[model samples]
Target: MPPQPSRRTFLQLTGVSAASVALGVSAPASADATPARPIPDGAFALGVASGDPRPDGFVLWTRLAPTPLATDGHGGMPSADVPVQYEVAEDSGFRRVVRRGLAIATPDLAHAVHPEVRGLQPGREYFYRFRVGNQLSPTGRTKTLPATGDSFSFATASCQAWYHGYFPAHRDIARRTPDAVFFLGDYIYEYGINAGDNLWREGVTVGPEHAVEIETLEQYRLRYGLFKSDPDLQAAHAAAPWFLVWDDHEVQNNYGAANSLYGVPPELFVHRRAVAYRAYYENLPFALDSLPDGPDGRIYRRYDVGSLARVHLLDTRQYRDPLPVDEADRLSEQRTIMGAEQERWLYDGLRGSRTPWNLVAGGVVLTAITDDRTEQWDGYPANRRRVLEAMGDAGTAVMLTGDIHRHVASELKLDFADPASRTVGVELVCSSIGSNGDGVDTDQYAKDWLQHPYVKLYNARRGYVHTTLTRSELTAEFVTFPYIQADANAQPNVVARFRTPAVDPRLEAL
Candidate 1:
């Protein structure tokens, strides 16, 4: 059995798993690590990825899967270790190889390899690939954060439900190939998937294990295999280094810490989170340092875009308080979404940041809509209050969030009820990548956001937000897709664009 997550404070990370006590641990190769047979056919069927960028290095990842949808959920591999070779080059072609090394793919991690590449020049483009026996994986492109720069552009994406629709939004993201990608949450839905033909996902077959909700370690590994097989998603992963943070759907919907929405005992739910978190680490291009120890993982961290900007990736699901049941509960000082320690860390970082732009990326919105306050920050008004006031002092802060399946661009206020309250920052809510099927321009929930003065625009569509920040101002483009299920190949269009100047938290039509 894999390590499970704990609902206790982040400091409780040391008791169970050895990885919990340290920053990172390498997968050990036992004496029986060598494969008993020759490498299988079509070994690299699941594609490759690179992420968690740094000044000198990035993490490279790939998994061996001859039968990607095997019922046993081991990617059809024997219980042994495989030697996977990796190559990094200055050009797309492997002719100018810069670095080469070997990584051990262990059965404990479903034959996945996460080799951290280092000693590379900053602000320079590089291409990488993996090789196993006679097979070679697709080439992936990424760059390191510069030691100094004047501008940076990145894309924010979230909520990709395979059964909901095709991934044209992901295809578009691959085409743009932003500086880096911030994937907020819902990488894969935990619900059971149907093998029928009428679903939005056409022409794909799922294994029998997918007919029910996933719970075990192998089940979660198989679920990731199904989602990672998409070519468009693979392209997006290969396009740039991605930074990821999970929301409810990664384990279960509407779960707060270990408090299951359907009333499962906390002790039992932790078992499910153990496998889910382990599978999440095995599939994504996450560095070994942030590997989950049971149900507790450290993902809330910061990234500095040289001298241009600063980015903060928040983890809300792992350490949040239980949902409030009434008005007084919502207003209680004890209520919090970011946990106490993370909140203090965020405020301290904001106060000490010297960059012109401070970007905060989380899974939920800070802006309050008239309806639906249970899961988002509106449910915990006390935490929301501190974040609002802190951003107001940060001078040039922007909030990037996703969860609601609608694109919302709003100006945030300290006191939303008062007409003359101070403007703290701007919130750009990115819509789903392929969730909720083909969305619409307006729906019943649309009115709840439109009547608010702070909301500048609301479009119910499936797409992402493209942002560019420079010394003078930050520009935003809300990209949307016309139809996802009906026309999987449809080209995307920019529905709205806005700009906010440095040190001034106000949006102007671009």
Candidate 2:
């Protein structure tokens, strides 16, 4: 007879099973030294990271993985002060140190810190690292935007399920070495997918022997740590500072504030959201103002890419009412995705912005696609129309979106049905980094939809979008990998290239 599973073994089997499924391995023995390591009693684990950099500053983040590395949120690590030192320099070496400071990693925030490093030269490349006593975390390199009027390049990506596939795209993004990376959402999936079973029999296994059920702060931390364990993600963070936002999987599926589509109870959803938000704030390099408070939280903020672009990061999840099932049209307008305040904030930013390109860093697709039952902009038609109208009137705007899980370059027309109206702005939708769904295919139905003059390039491929912007023009390219699970040395295929005039918004193939 097979040996009976112990309580510890049972917990490991279910809680992290999805992670194991991703790795394509059976649950390994607990005695494996490769999966477990011991840091010095006072040492911080999980290394360090930086995010959301402006011309003058960036947010640095790190956490103290609980002493025993508990997965159930009950490690009982007390609130303690961990002194963290941050350094920035022009050279990778310390010879020409420009900025240095100390900040306390407070227990109130699970021993995480986000030190906003300021007073640095703009548009120049710099290196930074965090230190605790003699132990040094990974050194990260970043660049601040040149003063407004300077032209530069940036990249955006989303939907990186660590277990779903490899992150060779990060390696590719690293090679291009853009000024910054915009991470839209789905940073982590909360559910446990089949590990090396059914569709993914060849995937490599990682952790949580079974599906994840807990939504506590500790659970979220473990998930983030698992993703950070990927060297590609680590290298991506090290390559450049990132502007980020979250989508459903970070908390639960199709979560809309008071509830989620997966049938989580209202109060239970609130608790899970609280835990997820707190964990997200702790793990990410966000400003202190974006911190969460138990259930109700704020993550919507904006980043200025100097005079080249003004990025307005909006929170589409936090304020949304529960999704409507049958009466989609009523909820389309009655339901508030960004709520009143955030919508107003976005509108104000777009209307008042003077940047050549107004990049709206949104979590969901802004353009409407047919038959997409998921919570896309189509489900919120009124909201979509309002946003498109705003972009049309604003004159210079571009929509960058995730949640579609496929690469598409579409012309934002006055209407999808009516092909005659002058195109308002160019909307570029990027495919997932590693999602469960297939890539966007240019099928007959897809081509039929693109019949509208505004609809330009439609592709179904697993890859990322690269946007190169300058004072003269803006170009968007859908860089596709040969396969989602390809090895580290995979090359990206430029499946389709679309460009638009910065003065007038129109999609044209290069």
Best-performing candidate as measured by lDDT:
1
**Cα lDDT, model 1, residue 311:** 82
The lDDT of model 1 is: 0.82
lDDT of 2 by residue, 155-217 (tens): 778888766677778888877878888888998888664565412413456445325554766
Per-model TM-score versus the true fold? 0.93, 0.85
**Clash counts for the predictions, in order:** 6, 21
Candidate 1 residue spans exceeding 4 A from truth? 1-36, 195-198
Q: Residues 1-510, candidate 1, lDDT per residue (tens digit)?
A: 223443453224322333321212233343233344678887888988888888788898888998888878889887766777789999998789988877767676788888888899888788999877777888999988877767788899999988778889889989998888999899988888875533577655566678788887778899898888788899999999999999988899888888889877887787677667878988998887787766777889998888777788898888888888778888898889999999999999888888887889999988977534778998888898888888877758789999998999998888888858988779999999989888898888877898888899898999999998888888999999988876569789899999988865688988
Which parts of model 2 have CA positions greater than 4 angstroms off?
A: 1-45, 66-79, 198-203, 207-210, 325-328, 331-335, 371-374, 437-452
lDDT of 2: 0.69
RMSD score of candidate 2 (Å): 9.3
List lDDT for all candidates, in order.
0.82, 0.69
By summed lDDT, the worst window of 10 consecutive residues in model 2 runs over: 18-27
